[model samples]
Target: MEANSNIPSSHTLWSPHDTVKDAAESLGIALPDEAAKNLAMDVEYRIHEILETAVKFMRHSKRRLLMTSDINHALEMLNIEPLYGYDNTQQLNFKETLVGAGGQTLYYIDDKEMDLEKLINQPLPTVPRQTTFTAHWLAVEGVQPMIPQNPLPSEIKSIPPFARGATSSTLGNDITSSGLSSDVTMKDRDDQSRNKNTGLSQNASEVKPLVKHVLSKELKLYFDKVVEVLITTDPEKENLKYAALTSLKNDPGLHQLVPYFIQFVAEQITNQLRNIEILTTMLEVISALADNKTLFLDPYVHTLMPCILTLLLAKRIGPASKDNNSSEAEDSLKKQLAVREFAAILLDHIIKVYGSSYSTLKARVTRTLLRALLDYSKPVGTHYGTLLGLKNMGPEVIKLVVIGNLKIWYKQVIEDSNKTDYEINILLNTILDIFRHIKVEVDNAENTSDGAQSISEDVKLKLEERVGTKLAELILEQPDAIAIVRGIFFGEINI
Candidate 1:
């Protein structure tokens, strides 16, 4: 058979004649035309066959590039001796040298020679320790023991807030018991059976709801002690109250008591409406809880909001004016204003932090404040709280709600003769403060010095028309009155 005729054209485009002739020359063998042709085709066929099998190995290994080891595996499968000195990871570098005259070139492997003497004198490598794992129960009879041998569950993955509707001590899913019913538990079932035997199931129709979390006795004691310290008439316990607030703000692992704190606040505020000190203390608790980084308070923010809004927008936070003497009433009024101020701050913080959790939370809170602020009958204290809330909502709320409706509220609530001069002055100062705390840097910030020092009588009437006469007169007192006035009507910096 003719080897050249049998060789596929696809396998040998350049032909292997030159390679075979060089090999025969090195061996000092005689070469003939027919023998060289046949040998050349045969070598090409064999080389192609080896690469085809290597390609299959590359594909089987799910690799795009074929490695040297794949060729060796293919050679072994074909019963051929693979060429030595080939490593899968090592690169084969070929150094080119200029050869005989005419600028000819020769390329060969750039192998680095090793020193056998130096290698033999080197220190022997240390033996690796044997691989070992100790046997330990991860969980015994459904309860995970807190041991160093077992990894803690928290390190593996984070438990999302409110993701677990219910949990069990024995809720093992590793080829063990099924889940417990939401409405009942194992202990409840046992108690029901005992009750039935004693003819008591007739009275107890259903089991009470399962506790969402098990509160430790230590936490309950701490909570009760904190509440007692905060509400005690004894001024000596002020240190203890400060310590409790500090712990509530900085301590970790207090997630279990978040709901209880919110509840304690709600109940205290309701029962102690007439008591300013208690109401202020409760607001402090809410603020401390919000500041705690470890507590997942997002789930309980909705429940805590009512207490904040109540304190913020309530008509009267302290004793009725008619029931108390003038001095006592004045002091109580200051306390009321303080409670409302703190409540407003807390509400603004909650909306900013958890606003993304509920898309409409900010909007709803803004609407509530607006309603209280716009109502002429809602007392001056309510307007003060709402203004503070709107101010804290950011520049936009201040610009749109507070500044836009300042005329109506200032004229109706601020100028009301029914309210005391002290209350009116306090509210007026708050209006000025809304402008003071408002930090809007206009493009005309540089031009404030260049602009007119005072508002002319013409723009003054427009300013008074914009915000009530009282606010207009006060705004004119500032050096940047022209810029503030421009920012208000022309959207420059008034808010």
Candidate 2:
């Protein structure tokens, strides 16, 4: 006879002897050992056949795992009846039951029957209450109130040395700030320093000291309100910002606020350089303050110069974009250039308005812009802005300072392609435009200066040497380049 290769081996998980024998005996058929073994092998082969079919269903369903429904389908495909009461509706809960005979353990599903009316009659649990809070006095006049909620007198901390006389948090000083003595605040500071050096503990007082300048609470409130409105980035706050700027410009009582505003501008510019909006707003603040006719800003003009100059001469103004090719980078570059231009305009305004008060203001500002203009290390935008500033100062400045140095500066600017052509073109346009205007203005001042003046070959070469060959060519391209160059040869356009 042929070997029955389908017979279950010892590795069979469903042991043929124990399980198959039990199933057979349950049906009153006392299965012999050989018969049990054969039945077990047939059962195992059938199970494998069903599972193989089920795997195909699972794959067609785009699933990695086999489901009960897949097995059901697989049984139908094999022309065999599928088992019931084992599905994925819920997890199978097995109840442990031990038979007393041999202490044999068996697990079975426990589906308890319930009284439907009893379940319906059960009452719901009570609902929870909403939350509430109570308030108490924490402190008064910088001293803790002796309330149950506050610490006892003995538990209170000592006042620090500098804070001895202050009433406002940071703005106040102690008894010294009482307006009784001028030097008391300074001396108290010395005492605090000495205490620190000697490891002495200075008790913090609950008493807040009076602020310096004895500034009214109204001033403090106004300063806070103005700063908040100016610094906000919300589009909805535009009207509020405009109102705040208007108040800064036109308010007569802002005399006391000038120094504070200057200090605020200086600090913010230093700390928030990347925040283009805030930086631009800060410049607007300066413009408003300077525009205020009622206020005297002479003492603080020099103080404000550093902030403006930083903006004017900064290589990059706003936050740098992550990708150079992105629109964000282009926008940032444009905004930064605009900021430099604004700073230039503000600088010119300050010189024109306050220049006479301080005789050297105009001269110093001119020199600064000239230096920045000639500086090849600066970005192209900066040179362009500097040129704008010179033009704003007067027709004479552009003629005297810019007309002579255009070639050398522009040569290096174009050679280094670090800045984009858009920037370079803008600069070139500005220079060309300024040269054209200044020539017309100078020549017009002399007469209808449309007449092109002649120049010698030697003068043209000198012109190339002074300003590079490329610039000489562009200058010659202009209608009045000869007249301008001829004027330069003579004393018509001064350097």
Clashes of each: 2, 20
Q: What is the Å distance of residue 232 in model 2 from its true position?
A: 0.8
Q: After best superposition, candidate 2 residue 133: deviation in angstroms? A: 48
Scanning candidate 1 in windows of ten residues, the lowest lDDT window is 171-180
Tens-digit lDDT track for model 1 on 1-495? 596665334334435455666688899987765677677777778889999999999999999998988899999999999879888777889999997687778899998899999999999999999999896665543456888986577853463222322222222211001111223445565675575456634454434345355578998898788778878878888888899899999999777677778878878887888888889888888888889887777667667777888888787787777734388777877888889889888888888898877566777678777767878897777877888888788767888888888887777876654787777878878877777566344665544543444446677777788887778878877666655666666543232
Query: Per-residue alpha-carbon lDDT of model 2 for 186-303, expressed as tens digits?
Result: 6876776576556744563345645456579999999999999988989999999999999999988877778899999988988888999999999999999988889888767667
lDDT of 2 at 187: 84
Cα TM-score per model = 0.54, 0.52
| Segments in model 1 whose C-alpha atoms lie over 4 Å from true places | 1-213, 323-325, 439-458, 490-495
Question: How large is the C-alpha RMSD of every model relative to the true structure?
Answer: 20.0, 25.5
Candidate 1: residue pairs that collide: 487-492, 487-493
